[model samples]
Target: SPRFIALCPTTLSSSSSSGAVDEEEQRLRSDLRERFLRTLLLMTDKQVEFNMHEKVRVRARFGASDIDVLNFQVSGLETPLGVQKEALLRCQDVISCSFEL
Candidate 1:
């Protein structure tokens, strides 16, 4: 993952002394990534509200996200103008998103 690589540049380089520490860090990062992916999977097809930049908020049915989690695909996206049948939201514009159980 590009984000992972950017966050942990040391993982890409060779370091013998901290190899054990690197392995542990990699394991923890893997677990976190797995959990995040599972959460996204659970959010699929659910009604979600996305809070975006400039105090913009919209609701939609969650579809899927790109592999890098840089964008979200949604259906029935409600906006100020009208409801969009389908839309893709940039993750950078979104501050947070939520859905009820």
Candidate 2:
């Protein structure tokens, strides 16, 4: 197997104008980040896989490394406006998403 490399690795946390981080979201982000950083940060170009027509998680390919999603978070950009609608729609399509370790 090829050794994974961190092209731009750094620690990150969430902050809002109100400076409050939702615990659940924080946990989810933390979990995703932990999974991502433990391996390699697959480039952002990796395919966006639809696991159940509703659940969408980026899949890291050959050139990509497993990366904590937070590692890819923008410094100041906020969440998407329609993100909630999309998430709700996804949830309706898939009961849950499971990742392979």
Error of 2 at 58 (Å): 21
**What C-alpha lDDT, on a 0 to 100 scale, does residue 28 get in candidate 2?**
75
Candidate 2: where is the Cα deviation over 4 Å? Answer: 1-21, 41-101
For 1-101, candidate 2 gives per-residue lDDT tens digits of: 12222421211223342234455655776797677565444323332332344334432222322222212221121123323212212223433333333
Best TM-score among the predictions, by candidate number: 1
Clashing pairs for model 1 are none
TM-score of 2: 0.22
lDDT of each: 0.93, 0.34
Error of 1 at 85 (Å): 0.2
Query: Best candidate, lDDT-wise?
Result: 1
Per-model TM values vs. the true structure: 0.89, 0.22
1-101 per-residue lDDT for model 1 (tens digits): 76867887786674566888888988998999899999999999999999999999999999999978799999999999999999999999999999998
